[model samples]
Target chain A: MIDSGIRLPWNRRLKLLIAYDGSSFSGWQRQKHDRTIQGEIEKCLSIMTNEDIFLHGAGRTDGGVHAEGMVAHFDCSSRIPDQNFMRGLNSMLPGAIRILDTNTCDPSFHARFSAIGKKYHYTVFTGKVHPPRIRLYSHHVTAPLNLATINSCLQAVVGTHDFSSFENSGSRDKSLTGGRGAVRTIYSARLLQQDKDCLVFEFIGDGFLKNMVRNLVGTILEAGRGKFDAEQFAAILAAKDRSSGGPTAPPQGLFLKQVFYQDRTLDHCISGKD
Target chain B: MIDSGIRLPWNRRLKLLIAYDGSSFSGWQRQKHDRTIQGEIEKCLSIMTNEDIFLHGAGRTDGGVHAEGMVAHFDCSSRIPDQNFMRGLNSMLPGAIRILDTNTCDPSFHARFSAIGKKYHYTVFTGKVHPPRIRLYSHHVTAPLNLATINSCLQAVVGTHDFSSFENSGSRDKSLTGGRGAVRTIYSARLLQQDKDCLVFEFIGDGFLKNMVRNLVGTILEAGRGKFDAEQFAAILAAKDRSSGGPTAPPQGLFLKQVFYQDRTLDHCISGKD
Candidate 1:
């Protein structure tokens, strides 16, 4: 067994509250040659602890999808203080990825398995000109969007549903899904903010399948564009077929805003929203 | 004269309201070979109009400084409607630089010579961790700043003063001084916003010397950090020597927020600030 020169246990589970700008990475998963958020963090942790450390993320985000509170866990015997890991990792990793917080947790706690829900934000710029500063964080559509139609469409996605119509086929492994398959519960779905030229959509769900949020956004956008009404959007959802959904929205506009473990209430997930 | 088939003036002055992410560009000014906001736009304008186009910026922002409403002007014989220039140039130009608005102005109206004043924003992140999403746009400082002291210090800079202490040497042409060397008017200087972990400083002035805003921000930040008091800040201004000023703040936090022409009222310069 590895020694930390102390009486404490050799391996302790540490959970990291993370954030990353997804523009520079291939994605969140580790690949052999590609740069990924997980791969970079794992390599940094391994170097810091002098052990091969594998990080378990709450979920995988596709390339160009940003995150503000992505959770991950890894075990190490380095004996370093929890705060030092945050500081060290932030200094070692590229500016695109940051360790927001770190803490030692019970061995039973798992970043992925223990996560009860996740919150995401998809921002769209409906203005004629997309400002350069926010171009990376928002999708631009010059066409005027119907906010009433978008809100009505969003209401249909709140309950538990088999979201196969919004899931991209072959993007997930069958075994890892743990028999849940396409069924997921969306606790809250609404537009958080609607400014003069921008819309911020917030979704808190039990879990998401691969590209589920983007697909939902794309389909909802079609309804907002008058391609369909609320009834048609619900019909598409009821179809439960992958081919029934609209195109997948681009990744840049999506952000994994937060992940919830024990607290799944709307008030807890959102700031000051009842 | 260039033929447009339908006859209009061969040399109509066109004004452009522009924005850019300055991290990827060398600076606003065009160099022989270096990538610049002006160079890229000029090249595209030349290609579109089939004539060598020269762009005149209201002012030059240093490398890594962003702009949301920078103004410029150029003369061309192209009969393309004003709207088409905005659309066509945006398509040809990189996403980092955008033309927000384009309009034909009188031949006597020069972007640089006719400019009245400019407004700039300096954003600082005081949180322990700078979010990756805003890392390119803000400066991070972990130390708590004295907002009261900062505001008091800002009050000293709200009138006409010789700001040579904040001007960098060799950055401006001596002949361009126009007989009022090192002196400029500051109509407004104050802290625009103070959120949980961020402070935004706004400066509106008749004109600014090279590196004036950044140097002033650095010196004011020094006062905010208790390096000096308001009286001492005024004394630094009175010194009129560049050596008396504090360090020059980084360029990333600076933004050319807007440029004023003909209108100089505070109500017009800021949105709902009056």
Candidate 2:
């Protein structure tokens, strides 16, 4: 009943690393009345390949969120050459969405399901006045912050814990299965480059709930602004409630910087197209 | 009668150094119904200041012709603070159109009439393939050519001449104000930095007729391809007819790099803005 070795329907699946400056989009997912990057890609793919090609993302990012190494997967029956796919798909996509790399997978490699650990980088430009060039890509923080204080707070949120304190209250569980609660294992959380204008916070984890990274960023930002210290941050995480969390940060600074997988079984032919 | 000293018009004329990426726009000038950079800027200004703003440009750039330092002038009766006018006008403008610098000028300082010389840069990517990152800003040429040969031919068209051969035969003759073709002076037209992938041609002259730079670029591109040798280029200039010109290159590669003003009127205010 498992059908592990049944080569009868061994279809082809493509894994892709897509980057987008999502300023003019509604989000990664398909919406009822708004334009989404996924919807655009799906529509363009269906037209170009003459098939109903649905796109699956590693995770859906909110509006205004940018990505440099965002991952996604889709199955297709067309016999298009892999070397030309990157050019073709990119030609269809607008200037904002860029297909950085692509590869053929074992048809079972779902971008979300097969992931082991994911890493996200949030960039914030901390200055009294933000420069014009980096305003689009980074969060402009006018408040004065100390790096040592923020790092101390970030260290307490790294390990395994029930992350109810960091979940977005407005976000709903969108899976077919109902009443899901998050108990994700956060491998590491460190505020990297705390001493620079372009501040980066990298979070490596097995899996993440909705808006988890952004919420964590919000918490760290509060700690940086001296609203709460490291011990207070730990106590808030121990509360196990959304009300105990800090304010959710804006999506503009959060990036799906890199997506991790159990097996990066990608071919050169597909990746070479870029 | 010129209103002098005692009575002055309430509206003041301001000069603006505008920069734009032309890929998303129709052209510099406004069309009947289509979208153009000039039209968008004027529309935004009209909306912001509650006045009908008209844009008078130094030169007319065709569709897909970008500019780094294009010049334009406008008069506004609104009580525009010197500091706020530059910022407010740009804040209302689209993201692509940036007011690089601003200056208040004499009422009679027409953007087109007061111009001394214009410097345009034509960028060509000469390699086996075009670079994806810079594809929008440059032209792609696959055939390899000798740099020394191309550089030698450029030395011939440096000085003053009747560049009818480098003007489009069928292009508009608006420069023939009184039925005489423009006999403008060409200070320099040289090709610099000719290596593996990039060739930049810098043209500085008193003025340029319609499609003159494109025609010049086409002529040089042909010479670089070994079709038009040095002697043929000299003959083309001597012919004093547009039919003698070579192919007209695409408009994407050309950028209005800078418009040089003889006086130091702009540098003072530009320094303050910076």
Candidate 3:
């Protein structure tokens, strides 16, 4: 008995490119009380569509961690045009969060599962006095860092290895359930001089465990400051024990730059214009 | 007949290079009821030295206007070292303002009167949607602008001219007191592409009348949008009437980059690293 009048549910998968300051957000995850990126977006989308919409983000960035090109997606029953969805969502969202772009994507395009790799940047301002203008965007390190040492240490970080030492304990249980161990492939790692006093550390990898990027930056900074040598850093990585690594760097200095997918089509969709 | 014990005062003039996020400040001038850059600095200095300290800024930036290298000077009778002055002021001042560098300068060094030239930059974000991260630092213009047209129009603005048309009414009274007319020399004017969607208008001139930079940016943006041809823009300048010019642009996009002094010794004081 086919109910012909029960019109087939019209569903569309919408992908969004989002950017947020993260200074005011608890994180990307939705929480009942805390203000979060995902919570804010979902609340706005639900009001706009009159349906409870859940957002799936590529990465769950921690509090005080910013994003320039975070990817997310959701299924919507409403037939809102792509451009209108972007404009509507942005208008409803707070000034701290923004939907940079919106597009219709294949149903199978999952923001998290389909992601192949991700890139992150950590900025450090080594000026004598931290400039007030960039205080939120960068970490202030009054001590000058040796760039040559930092670059040399990065060379050792650019390869497949078990990054358990770099992962915080909170994410260990989740990694264990996957049964793939803590081994992850790092495609590249490099140190960039943003200006005379700002140093940027960029990492591109297959995946990152919670606090992995921050921990790596902290450890690398130690080597840059001659607190430890590259050999000692390599030894810490081989230990695979969190206690063997340096302290996790502050969250404010970290930024999730972009998430990459295997589909070449999605690459072009990520606006290279910005 | 001076008391021998009351030695002649050794007042040291200290120059400070400051940077501030103007979002929270009323302006650079000292106001009785409003929070301002000068007022904040004076309060902090008064607390530190128990003496009334007055700061003379290189430019009296309007509300919501930012500065990267604003120079200011104050006479200090307390024998505090230059480094200690910087550290003490920063420790007491709010996080929104910071002293980038501090040095003892010649007593004749006046932040305003000693300046021979100044540079200001106005940033416009021409992206489809303004990224929330840079909203306070740049003006968001959704429509695409023709850079070539803007550059061509800038050619007409490079030389010295009577900028009366671009001066706002609030500043007209001050300009009239000079009796030299509204004639001012513009050393250079150019359009710079900061990134894919960020256009930066850089203006280097002997001095700028109040609201002159904002008005010029407004008129130049109109020319970029093809609202008025280059010849019309030239005529607007020739008209020497405020009503003939475009509306004054908003204050958020304006930044006082540097103030140059004619003295070769002071010239070296400007940080060229940035």
- TM-score of chain B only, all predictions? 0.94, 0.87, 0.90
In angstroms, how far off is A209's CA in candidate 2? 4.7
Candidate 2: docking tier: incorrect
Model 2 chain B lowest lDDT segment of ten: B265-274
lDDT of candidate 3 over B183-254, digit per residue (tens): 888777887788998999988887888899999999989988889888899999999998999988889999
Query: Whose TM-score is greatest here?
Result: 1
Local distance difference test scores for all models = 0.90, 0.76, 0.85
Name the lDDT value of residue B269 in candidate 2.
Answer: 23
- Identify the runs in model 2 with alpha carbons over 4 angstroms from their true place: A1-10, A19-25, A31-35, A43-52, A63-68, A76-80, A84-102, A116-167, A170-257, A262-274, B1-11, B43-53, B76-79, B119-206, B211-254, B263-274
The parts of candidate 1 lying over 4 Å away from their true place are A1-8, A264-267, A270-274, B1-7, B264-267, B270-274
Tens digits of lDDT, candidate 3, A1-274: 9765634247889999999999889989999999999999999999998998999999899999999989999998987788899989888898789898898898999998888888899999998777777788898888667778888878888889999889898665564336767888887788768799898988888789889999999998988889988889999999999999998999999999888886363344232322
The residue pairs found clashing in candidate 3 are none
Better of 1 and 2 by DockQ: 1
lDDT of candidate 1 at residue B186, scale 0 to 100 = 91
Cα deviation in Å at residue B82, candidate 2?
A: 1.0
Q: With candidate 1 superimposed using the best TM-score fit, by how many Å does residue A84's alpha carbon deviate from the native?
A: 0.7
Ordered list by TM-score, greatest first? 1, 3, 2
